[model samples]
Target: MDGVTIIDHPLVQHKLTIMRSKDTSTASFRRLLREISTLLCYEVTRDLELTMETIETPLMEIQAPKLEGKKLVFASILRAGNGLLEGMLDLVPSARVAHIGVYRDHETLEAIEYYFKAPEDVVNRLVIVVDPMLATGNSSIASIDKLKERGARNIRFLCLLAAPEGIRNFQEAHPDVPIYTASVDSHLNEKGYIVPGLGDAGDRMYGTK
Candidate 1:
């Protein structure tokens, strides 16, 4: 779809296939999740702003560009988001990390925040809210709302996969923030699960079963 980033890297696609297989072992699943996230991290940070400065080479000095500002505050939306967070850290080792835990109300389908914390100067820094699944967007929206309350206007949503309905809902609610996903599949199922999604990101990631 337009305005959506569906990463089509061969490696990502291949790993996703393995992750999707019910026969895959938990160890393999976890490893692939990390690998895919690292790949997506490269794509997600491609547009980050940069400034040029003089640098010294062995022979001489030359102007070069490096990442600027306060680096980034990656606010992981708990358990599942941690999957992507670890990989992101590998790429942005100096980035500040925070946590905000939110859960879904099975009956009401509303997001409930049980925990929230952030960096001291989160607003001035580039912020990224990450979770692997953007199912109904409630959690992402709520997490963003909390971050905004703390003065985080500059933000991005990173998900490994998304459902069209959730994407629409999130875009409508927070039109200002852009979303990044490895893939956006079809509509959600009757029970609200994104069809063909890697089932229950939290459960899958943690081997809760």
Candidate 2:
């Protein structure tokens, strides 16, 4: 828990409860995911640097705070990560986007990368990698590995839910990148699914599987 931040806002918790219900419809689940994602995005970027710039008001000139340095890069881990990506973009419209296509091999739970695209200027900009569940940490860790290989120095990981095993694995693999999530569930089931989780986030969101 040393490098994890949980977003416990009332609205976030309320929506997450609904999302956890098996009775929830796909449309409702998708809507709640987008709404909760916006709230989570707010907490993840809370410490962004700020600079002051002079601006003219209707009657006089004033200095206003503005974000400093390059715009943020939201590196989505493909498919399910895009669920969080949509709402994050709603909050930070100017943030750059990166797509890393990686999937878990159901049998081995190993991450396989088939596609990757990111801004050429990822050297100094902050990159936040997103996925709905961190059950095994394989995909998240592999995605960050690709980002770092491309010269990304400052990075963070964001997810809707995380398992203790996944968190420990992620921390051991990439301690430098902090994690943000709405909840750290009890544990992962034998099939690599988060116990009591809202099922497959990607499937629930898109009505797939």
Candidate 3:
């Protein structure tokens, strides 16, 4: 809770509810994720520093506030993270994108990274990591670790849903990175699934098992 922000906007809540329903089709779920991500981006970027710039309007010149920092970088955690990435990009088209591919080793339940690619100047940008679900926190933590290894200092984690266990682990692992989610679910089930969550977010969105 210290470094986490739960986005409870009306539109975000409503869309989350629909995503939780078992009857919701894959296409609908994907569409809702994209829509909800736009709202999440709004909150995440609320405190960005702005600078006044002189600009010419039809009749006169005026100073207008504009973002005054390096371009943002959206670091997505593999296939599922892409769902949130697409929508966030819709809102901030200029933001750069980084892809981190990690998966849990079924037996060991350990996160293994197969691929990682980030912007060349990650140190100068605000890196926002996107993932649909924060369950065990293994993948999320590993992704951030990779980003930090690549010179990223300013980072934030964004997800559609989160579990108490996952949040605790993430906060403990990276206290500086703030987390944003639509809902913090009851808890994670035995198999590492968030209880009352929208099933497997990647599977639901992409129709994979």
Candidate 4:
């Protein structure tokens, strides 16, 4: 709760409900994710620093405000994370992108990394990690760990759905990093799935199981 922000905007909530329904078509699900992500981006970037620059607008020159600092990096956890990535890019087209591939070992429920790529200036810019579900927190923690290893000091985690267990675990592991999500579901099922959550975000978004 301390390091989390729940985006309860009506539009986001409405779209999430449609996504949860099992009857929704794959095309609808993908489109909804893209739309909801735009709203999430608005909230997450609310506090970005602004600077003034002189510019001429028709009649006279006046100081105009522009975003300060280096381009922010959106580090997406592979496969499913890309679903959110597409929409976030729409809002911040100039932002740098990073991809991290982490898979869960079904039996042990541990995260294993297979691929990772990031910009050389990652350490200097703010990094926002995107994932669809925070069920176990293992992947989220591991992915952030990899980022820190590469000198990333400022980081944030964003997901569409989260579980109490996952939230607690993620906070304990990375208290400095804030979390943004549309909903914190009731709980995680025995198989590490969020209860009442839209089933397999990756599968729903891409029509793949």
Tell me, by lDDT, which candidate is best.
Answer: 2
Give the lowest summed-lDDT range of ten residues in model 3: 103-112
Per-residue lDDT over 134-192 for candidate 4, one digit per residue giving the tens place of the 0 to 100 score? 99999999999999999999999999999999999998899999999999999988889
Model 2 per-residue lDDT tens digits across residues 1-209:
79999999999999999999999999999888899999999999999999999999999999999999999999999899998999999999999999999998989989999999999999989999999999999999999999999999999999999999999999999999999999999998888999888899989998986
TM-score of 1: 0.95
Order of candidate numbers by lDDT, starting with the best: 2, 4, 3, 1
Question: How does each model score on TM-score?
Answer: 0.95, 0.99, 0.98, 0.98
The candidate 1 region of ten consecutive residues with least summed lDDT is: 1-10
Deviation (Å) of 18 in candidate 2: 0.6
Which regions of candidate 4 deviate over 4 angstroms? Answer: none
Q: Per-residue lDDT of 69-136 in model 3, one digit per residue for the tens?
A: 88999999988999999999999999999999999776675799999998899999999999999999
> Model 2: runs farther than 4 Å from truth?
none
lDDT, model 4, position 25: 95
Against the true structure, candidate 2 reaches a TM-score of 0.99
lDDT by residue for model 1 over 55-139, one digit each (tens)? 9999999999988777799899988899889888988899999899999887777899999989988889878889988988899
lDDT for model 1, on a 0 to 1 scale? Answer: 0.87
Better of 1 and 2 by lDDT: 2
Clash number for candidate 3? 0
Q: Which candidate number would show the highest TM-score if scored against the true structure? A: 2
As a whole number from 0 to 100, the lDDT of residue 100 in candidate 4 is 97
